[model samples]
Target: MKMKFEFQFPDIGEGIHEGVITKWLVKEGDMIKEGDSVAEVETDKVTTEIPSPKTGKIIELKASNGDTIHVGDVFVVIDTEGSAEEVSSEDKKDTLAEKKEIVEEENAGVVGEVISSSEVIAPSDEKEGNSASENVAGKALATPVARKLAKDLGVDINKVVGSGPNGRVMKEDIIKASKQPSEAEHKEVLDETVKTTVDAKEEKIIVEEEKIERIPLTRIRKTISQKMTQSRFTIPHTTAMDEIDVTQLYEFRKKYKDSLKEEEINLTFMPFIIKATISVLKKMPEFNATLDEENDELILKKFYHIGIATDTDRGLMVPVIRDADRLSIIELAKKVDEVSNSAKNNQIELKDLKGSSFTITNYGSIGGYYGIPIINYPESAILGVGRIVQKPVVKDDEIVKAWILPLSLSYDHRIIDGASGARFLNMMRELLENPEMLLLKA
Candidate 1:
């Protein structure tokens, strides 16, 4: 007797509703163990590996690669040694009742009466029922659209007083609540009026708006947009910026390029930056943690798996360089080149991008001076490196030429504060300015 279990898509983060199947790691008839990777699911923010929840033979794949699957939609089926009837009678009863309740709710009217004919439910009457539920539950009862709007605007529905009939919350109510200025705005206005003398201030000027064109988002771009919106609204982000003098690093790279060429290795600045970041992260372990909201726990990683942000023709991809702490600078340079080339050619495997403990983005390659990169959710922080420029600096009370690299560090404020973030950035700067430290450790 063979038994089957359906593995539905799990919520990756926040309350995301769906994800696209980027690739399937296992095929039908493959024997899989519990916790083995099953598929790569690409949400709007990141492409993450989904593992097998139970050990069994995969009998069927419910969805194909590139197909969009919603939350609770079955994506895989596993066959065991028992038939469906072997499930306990109590479990069968519970399942049947749940199905019946869903059907009944679909067919029933707002007041609990069965609708006998084809008729549209009045929005007004539905609003009343929702309001009544809210009153009984002591929370705002909102439609899915209204809830999604509130989420995008970062508004708390409970604090928003509904203006619709029977106090049913509406999207308009949420928008109005978000638009209400805080007491700080009022204070600022009063202070401005007081500071400006009778005729000293200039007249306010209004500028006409320019026409904006809308473009459809690509698959990767769409995911980026949704994830960024979610991060901005859900997580409190604080940024720390610092500048490091990398003159010694520039000279060292130039000195070693020919030697590296002899070994068939293409040396780059990214590997050195990545090594320095991993070293600093090892010292500040809290910067390499994840928030397990369900368990109310913080997971700190001891090993370092660094994510290298690669800009490809398709989009932005961060392929991980696993165990960077253990690899030599030359080894790291080779791995970076391999991963980056793979990402550019679209030959990178899903596993190559998973299990990153930290991430570093080299915006300097494109001449960006500084940038506040988003925290790759589930990871505590990300390091951004800007272009190295020769600028004037004061040395021994005199100005001189110095090569400076601007660094931007963004972390989840809920987990780490400004002081810790600053310390982490400073340590990275010190390591980069003096590459000998990294070599000594190696």
Candidate 2:
């Protein structure tokens, strides 16, 4: 008797509704184990691996590479033991399979490609009717992340109790499973002799001409584009430009650089700006609020949690500092360093990017002197910090060199008026002008 399992698209991250399949690791008829990586999925914030849930032969692939699949949509089918030809012949004789194939093919290539054949087997009526039993046994479902986590942590998801809604296994379940010794007991169960070694002597170097293939944007990228378009149209944006004299701050940083270095803290100018921003946010609370559409409310957040926009090779990612107001300058600097490094390495988690009251983008680090940053939607304002340059300034009748740091603030007119926005900008200006104020606050 052969067992069939249909694996659905799992939740890749927090609040993620869908994902675009970037590539499939295995094709139909390929044999796969429970922990084998099956596909790569790109969510709004990250690209992650989707792993197999059961040990079986690939009988059918529901979605193709570059296809956008919603969470809970069946994507792949596996038969515990069977040839692809046998499965296809079985599917063709089933009426329900014919209808399902037609509908699936239509939606497959729209966002991705669909690979189909008559050899795939359709689930029998008795098996379809037994879904309730499968659900009860926790064999009918698992999210992509849950499945991946289970594999990574050496957890037996089938035996572990689920705490999530509908008895679904979650990340926590995998973490809990990691603490048990039994999880690793089956590590050497696979047939080691079946592994094939590469033949270096027979390998030949072949170079093919490079070709370019233009692929359409995945579902998450499309949604990001749409949201950015809506934000540009809805908000009447104006940039307020000013220069901050950060000479004193620069001197302060140099003096403490060695001390911070000894403690393994990379003291950058970002910490100074973050500390100053918190002080400024305290004076101008409106900049830290968001417009609540459902309640028609202007939600003013008294607490500060600043988001630092970090540009990665893939795209832009903004990870938030939780409770920026409560953290000391050193602590804030350390958090920024940790989050920025994680974002660059594609190791940042979904929860790290949520619930930010305001945002700051430091393009100055990369030699940009000025930029009009887009407001990170729902958040009322965003501050852009530019490069600090040494320029000539008049001091009482004489020319003197001063360090000037350019700043631009963009805010939503719906929640923050022009006057409020200007005041917020001025408050930030004052803090940057006198770096001592930041030390006082710290």
Choose the strongest candidate by TM-score: 2
Q: Give a tens-digit lDDT track for model 2, residues 205-296.
A: 22234332323444435545655665677676777777877788788888998899999999888888888888877777777887778888
Model 2 residue 211 CA deviation in Å? 14
Clashes of each: 2, 9
Q: Give each model a TM-score.
A: 0.55, 0.68
lDDT value, residue 100 of candidate 1: 19
- Local error of candidate 2 at residue 398 (angstroms): 2.6
Clashing pairs in 1: 3-82, 44-223
Compute the lDDT of residue 132 as modeled in candidate 1. Answer: 25
Best by lDDT: 1
**Model 1 RMSD vs true structure:** 15.0
Candidate 2 stretches with Cα past 4 Å from truth are 27-31, 81-215, 293-296
List of clashing residue pairs for candidate 2: 10-144, 67-111, 67-112, 87-119, 87-120, 87-121, 88-118, 88-119, 88-120
Question: Which 10-residue window in model 2 sums to the lowest lDDT?
Answer: 106-115
